[model samples]
Target: MTGRHAVPEAIPQESPAPAAAPAQEAAPGFSGRLTAPLLIGSLLNPLNTTMISTALVAIGHHFGIGAADTAWLISVLYLASAVAQPVLGKLADVLGPRRVFLVGLVVVIASGLVGTVAPSFGWLLVSRLLLGIGTSAAYPAAMAVLRDESARIGRAAPRSVLARLSFAALGSAAVGPTLGGLLVMVVGWRGIFAVNVPVALVAFGAALLWIPADPPGRRAADGVAPRLGLDPLGIGLFTAALTVLVFFLLDLAHPMWWLLAPFAVLTAALVRWQLRRPDPFIDLRMLAGNAALSRTYLRHGVSYLLIYCVMYGYTQWLEEARGYSSGHTGLLMLPMSVAALVCSLLGARTKGIRGPLTLACVLLTVGAGVLMFLSGDTPLAVLLLAGACFGIPQGLIGTSNQAAVQAYAPARAIGSAAGLQRTAQYLGAITASSLIALAYGQSAGDHGLHLMAGVAAVLGVLLIVLTVTDRALRGRT
Candidate 1:
């Protein structure tokens, strides 16, 4: 049982009839109660992901490892989530979202406990892997649950439900590092992981009380639900291909040219295999037809890559190069977090991806460009101002990309499409971890930080161009 926060895939196939209810109970906000538990669950994944950024230096110091080696803590988790989220989402569609959601919460609890007492770096990595797998379940399952509720109660639109979840996710992301910094200062680096325990426990109880059970025999009655014939072969090949690709990317600075051979071979095989299957793990043909959706996925990955570089990359440099304590570093980074919260709300109201996403790219460029102008002795006010600019994109990109995905994904494949959207995001996170390691090398410094920012600037420009010129992103039908 694992879940990550994701958009609910599609409308259910069999939406029998809406149940009779009082007028007050039939309103839109009525479904808001269901989001209470789902919101709590949604926070876990993003919180765990970003909170550790503030604590990474402490963990590396404790383990006597370099920045590059300790980066695996970030990379491994994203990698696991990228592969696991879609699979778990499919399971939620099959086994019942409530059941899967509870199980995921339990896994998070166990992972937190393991992390609290981890005696070695290896043990900590294991805890992160478990956490990634477990947290991956929440979003997809919650999405399923939300859709089911909409279906069962006869709601024409559940846009508000998703907005609530999205806002919760971004807000948690904004708070993660600050909360982690406080915990690290109070209870050492381990506190970041330990914190998940109490939060997950509350989420578990709420989920049990709020989320309704699956309508009996939904799966049993649909004897031919695609879950019955999942494409194991396609899944295996895709996972293997992705793993090889990750290795290749992580070793990009090195002369590991030989790795590309296997990566290319596996990727080709995966495409061929998936295309041949009657029900593929990922439908390449659908991706081809839904060009807008594919572009959204790519934009998510690229945008997140830049975001993580700021989150983890900049945090590491502030501590290692600028002599800030973990707590102070978190405090300094608050402007970015706060700005993201404000901008996300504004971005949500935009008509399409072009405006919000372009604004996101512009902000990204401004943030990263500011970093390139700063030295170690640069004013704290100036640095914080740059962070504020960076934070704006944090909120905007997420909501805009999610809206685009929802608009473009086919009704039936919504769950898988949402999962893949998340996968692209995680892949971006993984790429960021790799880039941070490669850029920062043995330790973080101003030079490396500047280089990373330059890379971010380049990405921002590319994203702007794509948003305007790409057919998929230009609001084409």
Candidate 2:
């Protein structure tokens, strides 16, 4: 369970849906009780994801597994969610967000229940798969709903939407770790999942009443219902390619040598098929057509990779290595996450200025560099200082980059653009986790920090090159 804040400027580039449409017209803000329920319900998405993160040790203890194996319990959920999101966004566009949102809650509730009571590791993985699928449905649905809500409110929405979304996304991010820590400390890991089951039920019930349906488009008759005609062969091959690819990388030191050949072949095949298909799963058109948007996507990918490696690795290092309580580990991460949200709020204020892009590049570039420096055996005060400098700036830069991509995307492709952008993020997280694991393999302490520093340096150089070559961005603000 994990979530990140949505950047400001997440609007649909094209004419999304006319305001008259059911789903197109945003639901009115409720007066009292509905507001709190809806807000809390919407937040469950983030809460569920982030809760499991700090609870890994408890999970491992329950299953009697090692850290490496338990790590997959987290990583696999992200992998499945990333792969499923683009497809789910298309469903949201067609079937209507309200429908998808409800479905997502239902899936989440069931998965949470399963995880809460699961008897074995195999069942736990199965439950995680269900959770991933549910989560895939929520992000797009939430974005679409927010977009519609903004439409009803006119231009004032995006300004405030960041805070609202951030509160849900980043707020939940901050809360999840702490709450998860508390839950694990109390009843165990299952208690974390147990809590989610009730929350999901409430969200589902409220959504059924408060969320509205969409009017029909010719292409979207009956609300983007799942089709039997989906290309199973292509999807299977693609999923297999990603699976083998991840498995191979995650086991780099051990090297599943034979899996590499199949992984390569399947990846090539998936690429070829995607290129030929009229409706590709990867939405290469959105990715390839816009230079700014594409670069933003890449920037986001690199940034997430760097962020997750340090944040995730440091958590385990804090708890397992340093003997901090889960609560304290969560507490330690608070400053960075809070700094990130604060930076986002500040960045949102400066949107559309010419300097935003440059400011973003500078912030992330320097932040990445600083994080590299702090990754070593730095003193606590020095590390905290680094967190303030780096976390705040990167938070601002990350959302700015996201907003830029959405701002520049082609018409009618907002869903693809958003989904693709997020995919870049998840891909980075997944890659970073594997790479950092490989780097840290059996090393005593802080040895892997250098590998990440190398990554930060390389990304910083690339950002500089890209910023220079793109003349439109220079002094454009």
Candidate 3:
């Protein structure tokens, strides 16, 4: 949860004052100070997520765990982040994005410090939990902050703002594995976490200097405590539903498929509870009422499921089965990131969502189909070419889907809508992590790689079909 939902009447309100007038700031597309720091802050989340991909094999070796057991490192972070992003977004709205953003940076700093010296896998897991909760704040809060600026200035959000945010996220993710590989070789696996400290500090200092303070009277009355507005019952039910679902998928290789019954029951109960609540943590009603919004959410989820499977699953296979050094693997993976960066920049000129989405699906299918041919002896050039194929979709999906959701959602609920989009993406990530664990129970061999690619191909096909059939995506915004 990133930004605050609408407050109930009984609850105290932020000051009714209008935002400060925009200064005669001069920047070609956006306010440089604001955009630069926000972009830097946003980069932390995706950078950390993908950097860990390259370091996973080393961490597993150090812990003496199999590939399946080691996957918890990735899954747990996404799980925590999936739940945290919207909550923090809500907090940002209630308190202030500046305060929440600063708190998140502090948490990240602390997480990095703890993770650097952890002696056991459990301790590292704790750090990742902190990282997940901390890093989740920046993007949604950034969105809220930008929206506030737009309203205050009597202008729409600059197209460059969303474009830049999307670029930073995907660009950072594209570079993370290669960067992590180099860092692993130079300073060992712990460098992956330790490196966050300095970068986060820079972002903190920059944000403190650049991001504006909230307007006067923009907080709950000091004497009277503000209501949290969280539905404890709904949260419990939703958490249980997601927990059981993820666990069921993770345990698919075992006899725990029966857990699906409880998961279904919990999901139904959650929907019922949310429908009745005035301020549910997750607005199930909105999702159900808005078909286009719902489709965007599902599409984002499946798109991420396919990408992360390749990002993490492929990296593991390259190292363990193909005998490539982490550094070499990172280099080979560069084509995907570079291609994504290029395509994202190009795709920004596109007006409607359909064209980019269709291209994304096509690229994804091609990439996944190519993966079917991967083997221990696959040519390096061919593998790099395949990585580039995957990269094109990576670039397109984030930008295209973000635009679609922003266009489709109601004006007042944009914050919640953005949070939901992140939730969907992270949920897909969690599913991908579980699938990775199941597919590569021991090692990422030919069979596992082929199966994962097939899954990606299926997701790509579904996305293509959705784009073709969904009218919402066809019209210009």
CA lDDT for candidate 2: 0.63
lDDT of each: 0.82, 0.63, 0.80
TM, every model: 0.93, 0.81, 0.91
Candidate order by TM-score, decreasing, is 1, 3, 2
TM-score of 3: 0.91
- In the range 1-477, model 1's lDDT, one tens digit per residue, is 111222334343445344555553465543556788899998888888899999999999998988888888898788888888888888888788898899999999999999999999999989999999889899988888876766555563365666777888888887788888888988999998898899999999988887887866554213444344457887788888878877877755685788789888888988998778766778887787667778889989998999999899999999999989999989988998888888778777776677778888888888889988877899999979987887999899988888777667876666777789989999999899888988998899999999999998999899888877766556521
> In candidate 2, what are the lDDT values of residues 1-477, reduced to their tens digit?
001122333453323445566643454442233333346555665465557667776676667775566657666777787777776776776677778878887888888889888999877887888887886776677666654544444332344554465456545654566678778777877887788788778777776776655535513212343333334566777788888878987777798999989998998888787667666666454456556666777767876675566555555555665566777766666676677667666766764533654555565556556655543345776555544554564456555665666566653455557677767777776787676567665431455555655676577667657765765454432
Model 1 has an lDDT value of 0.82
Where's the lowest-lDDT run of ten residues in candidate 2?
1-10
Q: Top model by lDDT, which number?
A: 1
Q: Identify the runs in model 1 with alpha carbons over 4 angstroms from their true place.
A: 1-32, 219-227, 471-477
lDDT of 3 by residue, 1-477 (tens): 212332211112222224453352222234888888789889988888889888888999998987787777787778878877877877887787888888899999999999999999998989998998889989878876775565345455666677888889889988998899898888999999999899889989998998888654443333233457767787678778877877777766784967989988998888887777777887666666678888999999998888898889999999998988788888878998898888788777787788888888888888889998899889888889888888888888888887777677765556667778888998888889888888889788999999888887887898789877998777745
Error of 1 at 391 (Å): 0.6
Which has the higher TM-score value, candidate number 2 or candidate number 3?
Answer: 3
Native-to-model Cα distance after best TM-score fit, residue 472 in candidate 1, in Å: 4.7
